[model samples]
Target: MKKNMDDVRFWPGNIVVAEAAVAAGCNFFGGYPITPSSEVAAHMALLLPKVGGHFIQMEDEMAAMGTVIGASLAGAKSLTATSGPGFSLKLENLGFGYIVEAPCVVVNVMRGGPSTGLPTQPAQADVMQARWGTHGDHPTIALTPAFHQEIYMETIRAFNLAEQFRMPVILLLDEVLGHLSEGVIPPKPGSFEIINRTKTTASPEDYVPYDTSEGDVPPFAPYFAGYRWHTTGLNHDRTGFPTTDPDTVTFDEKRLMRKVTGNRELIDKVEYFQADDAEIGIFAFGSTARAAMVAVKQARAKGIKAGLMRPLTIWPFPNNQVLAFSKQVKTIIVPEMNLGQIVYEVERSVHSDMPIHRINRVGGVPINPSEILAGIEEAA
Candidate 1:
């Protein structure tokens, strides 16, 4: 099983991503049919049985999540793939997954959205949605893939992060990356790192599902191995029992929050491309970032100093890294396939009054490079 990354052959990124997940021991996939993301589901459907894994195409988004959470509880590395609307539908279940500390991946092939916003269009609009859509003080791990090849690699990373944090990890995609045909050299089966969900060791008689030390990420024991544990949405105690003590709830909430939010350095991911003394920079994510990259180079060719800030991890925002570039640039342009979404977060983080322009396109088409280049100049 020894292989080098340099020796990897090219493949369609989604297929490589899917097969990598299979190779990483992702035994279960429950997803609904949605554009861009449907390939992941289709790939899983065909390949899972060959490797003795499970794949279920649910009747709807809700069912997809239901199956995902159910499978996760049984100690299977499980996940569900969907776009905007379907991602929205899975929020409640996402919350359930969070509180229960179930490790699974949620691949959101982001399409334009508020309500079926633009089914075929690419959007980073879900950037905020990925952060706040799910209820309460839970943490998130979201990775954005700008190209077909990274989609395969990042999906495996998402699973590793989920298992590491014992939280739901999101693979944020757009129509562009999901559907883009590109070559990827997938790692051989068992070649890439794999992380499994943590199991409990307190014994059934002394099990405390919510127990924790400083970090409070309780050791997670799998279900039905003669280990009795309870999981509920209600605020609970070390043993996973409902608690009314304000102090206990307060401690539990903070612990849950710290496990992910406090460890931003561990989760923050970004691609800072050519930001050395750049006057005009474009900030973008997912498929829109791909278009921005093209525009940035074209602008660079025209004697305008331009570059791209592409974030691999969207939810944690990589704000520290992004804002550092924002301070020096005269313009920080954000382009997406939605009317306006990520621009707000950028605006909120940057202190200077330098114009933060947004270039957006919706109605089933990706953002044109020309439009984004125009936006970059306008901001510049």
Candidate 2:
């Protein structure tokens, strides 16, 4: 198909995320409007129906999350978008999505906050929240991108991972990336990958919704599709019936966790820039990585060996890679828009006692490239 001029134009990161979700076969979007993330909801509201999909602006973030989970259960690829305060509201339903193993996407365009700290400003404070905001011990898969184009691509990848794993996946963006605009050449139709949830092939009477003989992940049959199965937040058996047996509870919890932990090799991803021969390494993610990259270049120009290790997949925390990189660098510097979330991960990953410097900023402004460069130079 020939590309139209309009198709390769610049777009804000949030808008691109919405478009990418649509291209990834998402047919349902249920979310409430929130700063930095509202554009995503608005775009979906306008575009989803045009493509024969469903879009709902719910009364609150909790309802928005519930709607998406229900839609996913009904065989529609669903998504929701929100910021910090709204994200907190969706935690309960997010936990429900986890236990039920519903396949859906949740985009959190992060804003400063413990309680609406800076609604319209950017911050990476929610990094830890994206991993542990929901209750219980379920596994999580989250992807962060640095630029507008990456935001577009990662949104599609988030949906694919959610479907492939039969769980909710998070695309973590901050105000900077969410509202930033840049020219992006949209992927050609059908050129990108799209994954749908696996369907059970067993007879209705024999179907077990949580059956795991296939692997840690069970085949999922859409609700009301001749596969009558029970699903609840309560611990359940392979038949999806509520259970109180210790062994069943233990096995169910492990299954929920292992589907992600056991498959870490397939899900973990990182981007290493100039790290092969660096004396100093900078660790960053999301939009913070953009400035980190620039800082790496500045350090190089100043005759200092510096590089960057940016996590594309934040959860499942990239431990092995961080450990390996730690061995190669004399010191590590972590610069984030928050007062230090991922720095703790880096500290835990380094087996050898290496000096780890934390350069944090939580006042809604991003850590500048100069600040990162200074940290790198000091570490060197």
Candidate 3:
């Protein structure tokens, strides 16, 4: 497919995200429609088949997640999109993906939550959930984009990282970013790098799906690629067979985490605005980061040395960057649509003596520039 560089389209964030997936060579989409995220599924359903790919609207979120995992294992780059309620249902299978090291992308367009609080509203309440929702010590790579263009770019990055690291990657969007429409320049073919999973070169009898002797990440072969291997949610050994030996279990857990944590330099990313000499830093992510950027500009215009630190990759949290920024600032202010989820990580990274203030808004309303600016002023 050729793209016209001279053409521009005002695309909703969800559509752009699906376009990115298609551009990244995503050949299979297994997802059920849900609010604020259904457009992603709709777009995929329309586009995937046109590109010789497959799309399926599963019976439910759980089935949707399972389908994607199956597709990925069969050598297809697969994806799924969902909202908070659907996201909750995906957690169990998400863990399965982690354990099996299936490369796929799961996009969560966050809405007001905790038992369907607000279906059409936006919230950042899922920050911590994205990190620890699966209930394990496994490493997670989650990217949060603040704008439509970023929604497109990061969706591509999510697939690349998933395939590279051989684990499920989350593209965390919010209701605002998912539903908002904005003009965007789609990337031309061959403009951006696309990564595919590495396949093993060893003979079938010698192949070990979970081997770590070469490195933390084992090269994976497609299920039907003449390689027969066992996979389970239970602890597994180098050959992919289930095991409960204490040594094997501990080794497997460490390798699972090391694939992501040990390579944080390559996977973790952040955007810093006016942060070099600022005394007050505003920490945020996702849609909240967009408003925080505006607030920082306003604060700077008013002679306050306020800057913004927006983490593009939320998990495997950027501890070093946050701590270093903390030392250079007197206070750090974190604003989110949730009631202080990321602030806890900020507090843990910053010096105990440094004041940390959180500006939280819940019940579907977004945190506006005024609220963040006020917090900046109060911190200053």
Query: For each candidate, what is the lDDT?
Result: 0.79, 0.91, 0.90
TM-score of each: 0.92, 0.97, 0.97
How well does candidate 2 match the true structure in TM-score terms? 0.97
Q: Write the per-residue lDDT of candidate 1 for residues 253-278, one digit (tens) a residue.
A: 88878887777877888886777878
* Residue 264 CA displacement from its true place in model 2, Å: 1.4
Residue range with the least summed lDDT across 10 consecutive positions in model 1 = 8-17
Number of backbone-clashing residue pairs for each candidate, in the order shown: 4, 0, 0
Superposition TM-score, candidate 3 onto the true structure: 0.97
Q: TM-score: which is higher, 1 or 3?
A: 3
Clashing pairs for model 2 are none
Ranking according to lDDT, highest score first:
2, 3, 1
Model 3 residue runs over 4 Å out of place are: 1-6
- Report residue 137 deviation for candidate 1 (angstroms): 2.6
Which sequence of candidate numbers ranks them by TM-score, best first?
2, 3, 1
What does candidate 2's lDDT look like per residue over 72-169, in tens digits? 99999999999999999999999999999999999999998689789989999988999999888989999998877678788888998999999999
